[model samples]
Target: MIRIIAVLMLLIPGLISAYGIKLMRDTLFNDFHPIFFHIGIQFFAGFLFFLGGVAFIGGFIVYRDKKKKKQREDN
Candidate 1:
């Protein structure tokens, strides 16, 4: 159950990063998303979203790994 919950939690950030990639792609093609008034703003927001999501996922995995390693050492 905990593993399943972890997988589900990851899906949100995965979707966020995917959306960020889409935004960046649209910016590259000169087709701006209507959410932002300017191209630069859209691109910058997308970049932030991508980095934030990736960082969250990376940190979660790193933390989990360290915890597991500690448990192994204790046993």
Candidate 2:
């Protein structure tokens, strides 16, 4: 269950980041006023990426460690 949640968390951010990148690209091409808003969006996207990445990595580490421990015990 935790692993499934972790995968979902990772995937959600990745999908959002892809769309956000495309939006940023369009923003760059278009004449959008208030560049500050774009900057804020970029920061938010980056934050989401960071958060999702950390959670996925941490969950994988924990899962792998547990699996290895279980194997060791069976030996």
Candidate 1: residue 53 Cα off by (Å):
0.8
Error of 2 at 70 (Å): 7.5
Candidate 2 matches the true fold with a TM-score of 0.42
Would you estimate the TM-scores of all the predictions?
0.87, 0.42
* Candidate 1 residue-wise lDDT, 1-75, digit = tens: 998999988889988988888888889999977879999999988898898889889988878888887434443
Please report the candidate that would top TM-score against the real structure: 1
User: What lDDT does the true structure give each of the candidates?
Assistant: 0.86, 0.61
lDDT of 2 by residue, 27-68 (tens): 566634454367557555646656665566667667777878
How much is the lDDT of residue 30 in candidate 2? 66
